[model samples]
Target: MSEGLSAARQRDLLIATTASAVITDATLLPFFPKLFATAFGVEDPRHVGLYLAATCLTVMLALPVWARLERRWSTLQLLVVGQLGAGGLAIASHLTTELWSFWACTLTMIVFKASYLLVYPYVMRLVPKASHAGVIGLLTVIVHLGGILGATLGGWVLEHHDPRAAYLVMAAGDFLQMGVSVYLLRRGARAPSPEPAHEGVPEVVEASADDPAPALPPIPQRLSPLVRLGLLMAVVYFSAFITRPFFVEYWGTRSSLDGELVSGWVFAIPALASLVALGVQHMGWSRPGSLYKWLALIALGVAIQATPLPAAIVVGRFIYGWAAFRGLVDLDLALFEISPPERYAEDYSHMNLCQQGGVLIAFWIAGLAVNAGGLVQPLWIALGGFVVGAGVFAAYGSRFVAAAPSEGKAPEEVAPC
Candidate 1:
């Protein structure tokens, strides 16, 4: 897959992907509710939740369409278009006074921003299978770091300057991403196509033929490997993200922390922990043999944070951050390793659609739970979701384990998971 690509181009593609990720993370992650509140004068928790859920829902709607577009366009071509659309929408949103218009522009922008979703599988296809874990780990680091930077930047703007200024910043990011994608697309045109294209979606079955399938639930066997993986991704994303929308609010109740900047840092504890994980994560002794341990630690972290103690909450974030990095890396590695190069974009889109579904539900539930009960309520729900997510992984994990890197054969030799 790496045959026609130069090393420099690979690095450039990664940089573009990282830029798109940081831009999206800066403007649209869970912390956006606070931004939305300040921007639109929205005070109700339900409104915040609904709007955030709407944002996520747009991504769900956009991914399948973008996935289908992959056949007609390169990922970079789509990114150029998406960034331009999103950037224009951001500016339009900034100009709007009415809440519904502002929301309409913002949500529409997300449908365009969703094109960045293609960056992951697009980059993965240019690299070798043996490098999957390392590539995924590094990308994971970029994502967490981007979250930390976004929170800090967004929080600072909210504290000292007009919160609406963040919209312009988002616009700047979208334009910058557009520029990078344009450069990459033009450069690639002068070079060979990254990989020989597949005619259509390849027929790759996930389960083994010789090994009898395990006693799984009533999920249809006809479901593609990517679709099955998507289901598992949905579960994990739901469990993990259930805590995100309400974290800043929850911190206010638990601690006297007054500044959005301070709260933002606290919100980014998991991202901070990602840096710590980077040091030891690549070490053989530190790596887990399976997904269960990481899943268990994530649950424990959520459980700890559910307590009212501020100190415990901080501690739990560290635990959750560390375990989440490992767990997500393994899960993503499983995803790309099994996916055929021909279907990288489409397969990842299917999986991410489910992942976004989980996040969308979590946003709604977290917001309403806080409105109905208290901030701590979402933590308990997240904890339960984590348990369910772990069970989902357990049932689906054998495919991942079978595809795991071994002494002689490449992980991709196993059927698509």
Candidate 2:
């Protein structure tokens, strides 16, 4: 609805911010037992899990504060501030040898890095409602690609140099993000301003002609649509992420090939799965209404990965990746489809906080589980999460249908909290 910039400029901004997002994921996703051991000489899975959970906690605490700042500053402006702070803190982390000092610097770095999340909703605002699923699909794929790249790079760094060198890579990524944000801000400033619109009037963007209808029904009038969606996504994310932190370690235990590089490649199986799924999606063969099927596949995949065989683990990763990419994209599509353009940034921030909460809890439990029962335990926990999540989704499905807004009406009108 904002007319300050043209569509071309918006596309350019999305592209630049997306590149930053890829780098951010590449730098951060590699954090876990390997990088933690390298950086702090701490190899205990419990402590490693705790540290990863703490990062999520940092992001959770910081997200709302950054969301509130959007009222006073554009997302690009905030990104510049965030990236500069994050980049500096990342360097500070590299300089520290003490565990607590490094923890302090890295956690504070996450606080600033949290601001870059605004790019998701900000970009969603720039495009038509119809293209939301396509965009979300592409972004999901990028996340997988970043994960693949990060795992490989992190492995190489840990193998060939001081493991702590990963922090320098993180710092470099943050600086590059900062550069992109600054360029966007300057470019926006130089563009001619559009004619002023009426104050206190909200603009409604028409739904795209080809845009699919909302995936599920609306929630009750007492709860907001975004809130309901966020809760549902939280559970789904928890199921998927419970196995994430210890995946490399798990691979190391099962496979005869035991170097960091091989483990990295094994760890990236899901990303490779995402690539195959993306190709399938590109061929227009993916079913839009198969959310339930995707969920079932995910549960089966988790079960398969829990087996003792390394080959089963690799096969399971591909299954999980394919289902997860489709399922997550569908959920995101559902989110934006029901949301009004005016609330994109605010709504997305709220949803992301819920997501972080889920991941936070998962990380905590994974550490404790691995400590108690060894590496294989978390996959079973993840399978249980998927079952619970699917149940919750089914339980809530009817309510959403009952409260769904009529065509062309904003979800707020029907589902306000």
Candidate 3:
């Protein structure tokens, strides 16, 4: 291993890993649900719901395992293994004839997916503490841009070729990502580990040799006003996706336009919103006091989404996407400001669990709302959640400001829990 590689090399590796994950996600997302529905010969979208739910469930289940493995293996090793595993699974998913086999392959991919999800924390550890906002902003830009490209390419591939072909393309992307990871690892380019602030604190402590283990962080006990606020943010974060399953269902039942085309537009709304968010970050909206401004914008976005027109729906989605990005960035900054640095990884993992759990809950609630009311019910529910999320931040935003970083240190930064 080279003793002296530039910081740039390490960041480049992180970006490559991040970009690969985004590409892989984008490649699969557009058509996987439809593929499963077709393969199972199920007409109702809810059957496809199980496929999506399975991925999340598997990721949640594997969180502890990912954490444990990270202690034993390098981050690069984990990234390489995950990419190859997920890629191979993507290819295998195309070959499966039985629904059970499909489900099993999907679960296998989920194990890799969970590790891929850890890229954020892994990358955070690589960058200098003072550059947190900039590095995070750049990382978000790469992921979103990759998302845009992947979704666009995946949609195009699906339009011109078979769904299986689309999966093949995704598999190829995963392989390419794996190659990149292997190259970085072989070249001895790795992310910088977070340095300990005090002499007694070891930056990279191993699990105890004598003791067996302790219990996972209890979800209820981990819930604080801030964590609760994070849950609300999760609601808003996922509300954007709540209407996704129902897009085809609602369009087919109600609208005159082509269901597939409209669904594409619906997906594009978030992508467009992400672009606007990138712009906001460029405008320095990431700083303190900007949270309220973004929340107000989110409220406006919700109101726009509630309008009846299809164009309004698309516009509303774009606004919400932008708002969602800002909301998440601000909330993350707030969380870091208040959290102790050493406990950052645990806190972040807890918040991630909450966010994913919230998504699962939102999906269920949205389904019920649609069953009871109609297509528009989920929108209203999401709008309410965003309102509450914004309100919580506004109410307690002062607590965060009071805890801002001193002049010598970086802006109140929280380690990723």
TM-score of each candidate structure, all chains considered together: 0.86, 0.87, 0.81
Candidate lDDT scores, in order, read 0.75, 0.76, 0.64
Cα deviation in Å at residue 128, candidate 2? 0.7
- Kindly report which residue stretches of model 3 are placed more than 4 angstroms away from their true locations once superposed: 1-4, 28-33, 196-229, 248-262, 280-293, 338-344, 399-417
Question: Candidate 2, 338: how far from true, in Å?
Answer: 2.3
Give the per-residue lDDT digits (tens) of candidate 1, residues 44-139: 777777877888889888988998887787777888899899889988977888888888888898899888887777677666667777878888
State the lDDT of candidate 2 residue by residue for 1-417, as single tens digits.
245657557656666556655755564464567666766678898897888889988988898889889878888888889989988998898788899898899899989999988888777766666687778878888788877888788778778877667778888888887887776676673222222334654445557989996666554656666667777778888888889888877877888887877787877888889988989879988656556668778998999998889899889988998888888987888767665666666667777878888999899999999999998999999998888767666655634322324334544632211
What is the Cα-based lDDT of residue 194 in candidate 3?
50
Q: What is the C-alpha local distance difference test score of candidate 3?
A: 0.64
Model 2 TM: 0.87
